[model samples]
Target: MPAITHEAEPAKLRLAVIGSGNMARRFLKQLPDSRRCVLRAIGDRDPGQARVLADEVGHLCEGDLICGTEDEVLTSDEVDAVYIATVHTTHAQLAMRAIAAGKHVLCEKPLTVNHVEAMAVVDAAQHAGVRLVEAIMFRFHPQMAAVRELVRSGAVGEVRHIDAGFAFYVPSDPKAATIVTPDLIIPDAGGLEGRLFDPHLAGGGILDVGCYPVSMVRAVAGAAAGVDFLEPVSLTADGSLSGDGVDEWAIAQLTFGNGVTASVRTGVRMVDNNTVQIVGSRGTIELLDPWALSPSPRVVVRRVGHEPEERAFPAPGAYALQMDAFAESVDGPEPEQVSNADSLGNAATLDRWRAAIGVRYPFERDDAVIPTVSALPLRVPAAAPGGDRAGTGRIEGLDKPLSRIVMGCDHQPDLLTASALFDHYVSLGGNVFETAHFYLDGQAERQLGRWIAARGIRDDVVVIGKGGHAPDCTPEAVSRQLVESLERQGTDHLDIYLLHRDNEDIPAGEFVDVLNQHADAGLVRVFGGSNWSVRRVAEADAWARANGKRGFSMLSNYFGLAEPDDLPWPGCLDVCDAESMRWLTERQLPLFAWSARSRNFFERADPADLSDEVLVRCFYGPENFERKRRAEKLARDHGVSPSAIAMAYVLHQPFPTFALYGPKRLDESRAAFRAVEIDLSPEQVAWLRGDQS
Candidate 1:
């Protein structure tokens, strides 16, 4: 650890307190009066309470204080440091916001509710070059520093085990009672009344008070090893819960990498004096009260066959020491006494402890654990998905039926949002999920994997995985990306795999052979090409037939009523012209068409308003305008949307075809489903295309 530089005399640092509850007031009372720090602002959810806090603290400090909302104080330039004493769940978010705005942060203990979010905040602070310190003030006490020094000096030689516990009983008061009802029970208040027992707000003895013992043990183990922190190899925890299903008392055991073991016990519903004992092979060191700011420091050092030596030290204010350290860290060569890495490690250990005790918050329950069999996911079930004749289609060499209207997942954000959309689609008899390797930075595939594992509905759906896109389109790239996509989706095989882009430079025969290799390994059920010309398909089939391998089973090209005047994106191929339709009709091959509605050119487009760049470059021209106009008249006559009419044009093509649909919400999905019910005769389709009068 690098030493923090201290100035001989420095100006006071401006501070903004983000919460006005009891903890905030306690911190304010303990702030040093040496003019090294000043309380400049108070921000809280309640303006009245914030103003009261501001008035009280303003006289104690050297600044004129004002009250404001969280946003005002966070974005204000007058604040040099932010002390976050908000609820447990809000610590990470507020700290990240302050770090982004170039302000130092002192977040209250249990730096975050969990490890995943804590890592995100720590990463953001490191990137922005800001100091992010956790306010576990007791660690900064002079008594603790003396104990660490004694342990480092080999006073307790070859430390083998540690026993530490912090416990206190919170009596039940009438004001903190739970409101009873027939179907639900609500808490009476927020601060100490309900927030301390609520799981959703991340309140519990484990997160609130047990964290002290956990961090202390970790530091003791590190001190024994001549480091600042040590990660435990395994952790086991058990707890007794309160009426609200949160832990009121808990005990945890951690084993370090160096074979040192430690036990930690904590509670808010029991009575015990907080103490720490470091037991070594030759001697032991004991601290009577270790986790309080006002406890008289009593230390006992005992060696085998020797009388114990008792020592006493003066008590100091922990919160004042913390505040003074934070003030010095504002222009740091290093941040305060606690490093960000130590905070991260502590949060991760607490997260594991919470998991072992089966304690979870509302926001962290989105993902369901996948069941393990020999450390592998279960095989996909064999039930065929529910489908209708008009909404489902079939391809050669594959047994599972696919939905005619495929679900495109290019912009899904997270598992929770994606799960809702997936549930709606399945309810509407949709079964296929179309995604690629690069969608949403590979999150789409990961979310789909978790959703399927959670619902156990893998056999009831068909997953379309695409790879080998553009510049790296080769046999090796295709194989590598297919395996990676399979791993991301948590499946052994893909129902349908398509090449996202075609490489004309590579021989068509080489593409077919590589695809056959995947099929032979049972990794791919059916393989096809996207954006490839009909001539290339024929050439690939000719080579496959000669070599006795599986040929391309489908063609997923752009086919819609409103033809593309020019390519909407570079290196994209559309087979919407007359010759491709004639070839498909003659061969009767399965056609899985993309952008089948002409990118919604008919629904949101008017011939009088062609101002959109995509509309002008892709689907706005004299012929497409005439086609959209005719589709509009047909849609009005048939009581459907113009987009549905365009969909009818693609579905009622010369051969077997399927249209891909991208719906952001449930209503949009329903509109797309309504289009599946509209059937158009060949004559009506030709009339809409302006082929006949």
Candidate 2:
């Protein structure tokens, strides 16, 4: 037992409530105000309410009392963090304001009503250099995490849908006269429905109450994305408005990036209770009042892997635990809190659906655009001794930030050769594959088909294919190429599809529509543009927006070292330069480099002998001679091959681009994968760019 050493006292959190609402009251009453936490002050509109709250537990928060305004509370001499439990409309503004005031804010649920406004709030909070949280206390429950664990653990094979509802009528203390009644005088008589119906204030049956499903969607979606909770590709929602024209009830269907979707039904004026059922490929997880309590009501798992099971953890005040965690975070350097932006994005999904359904709020100026809020995020990541540095390594738990190695496949005729290359690449952590119908005059697809079928590695590879290699990027070509590519690779569908070349004359929308149609049919999961110019990329993206089609996710092109005489290929060189690379980085588009090693452009038939191209280049071409000589020296310094230096040069680009390796041998593959782990410093890149430094 190691002599039963005494443990040190845990760190305590300091908290200040910015509102004296019922929820705030509940939080204050339940949570302890001792070492783990202490109330600095309470702010509310009514002095009576604040004083009552301050006096409710005199013994607990002995030194603290109530304040009049948010400013008074935030600027107080004694405080560590603040929690906002005020009106929904005030949520975004107040949270940003608090963050700006240099205080950590845990605003009550529903970060905001719209995506843009929500993003603004996040940006603002970031700018303020303080913590901001959208309080969805239910998410803190272990049962929800338990559900995620079950889904991820493969207990529910691949989850395709989540169906949930949180509904209960708020009659309020034996259901007397409404809040509008003059007898008692309750301000903001609009209540939840006021902001819930206001498109400006972020209202709707969904916005009013759709967070349950939208939040669940975030929990399930594969990417760091704010998925459209209604569209199947992303979301296309419809709502049922109440007598006030706000979303009293709503129905939404959201599709995940991976083709998984959820059917959501949520409302506030419901006649009954709430329930959630997560339907996966294996089975379903059903819970009654899942958002209700810890030990969290009861979780019933009907999974395919095992017989149906029911589990209940000994959850005692899970919400308190969440508050404690947030408080502790504020008390420390970095808080374990998800930002208000995440929560706001989710609520905006509901708001969008409500807007589409004509649910309007008081301040909402336009039904199309959700009301915008000013936002600025302020948290600066921990600095190194020398401050910020480029090509920096990993930031822990980056919310699905970036993939390291870009996977490439050679469209070679010999299926075994490419397959062997792919298998070796996989062994080395490469999964992003690139292929084309016209590769090797279409024989490469057949080879990949046989190879993938033999390896049964379809799930492991993110297969990318091209269809417009032929004259017309027609619907027929799209269909034929997709089917043929699938057949060749022995896959049901490619992970991504690219327009091999842009038919400048063809309306980009038509191509997007064709891709969308195929995508709808599940032939191509993600369709992108290859050899597309910035203008064409913009055009295609616009078309996708106009036609409600999926936009491009990747850009593939021939972009690497040139021998001065190095010529440009159609559409291939559009994004080849440093400026274009910077643009791609800003767009967050994943760039897939073709001919990364530039072997075919310059390398000799034999490693020992420099071919005529290499010989002619080194002796006659001024730029080529300098490039070779510089590469030789750098390779010597790094103890890597000159060819490895070339590969690293391409890999060195900032925006998460991967090299399309066309290695002719296993040794080449060995060298290429080895390059993924080697990150060149800015100095190294500059030296290579100078080529003769």
What is the C-alpha local distance difference test score of each model? 0.79, 0.62
lDDT (tens digit, per residue) of candidate 1 on 513-579 = 9999999999999888887889999999999999998888888888888888786776678877889
* Model 2, span 556-662: residue lDDT tens: 77665543344334344446666677778788677677766665433442335554564344233555545656666777787777667777777777676666766
- Model 1 is weakest, by summed lDDT over 10 consecutive residues, at 370-379
Tell me how candidate 1 scores on lDDT. 0.79
**In model 2, where do residues sit more than 4 Å from their true spots?**
1-7, 33-35, 170-201, 221-232, 294-296, 304-307, 331-341, 344-348, 360-693
In model 1, where do residues sit more than 4 Å from their true spots?
A: 1-8, 33-35, 176-191, 367-693
Alpha-carbon RMSD to native, per candidate = 20.5, 19.1
Best-matching candidate per lDDT: 1
TM-score of 2: 0.52
TM-scores for all predictions: 0.57, 0.52
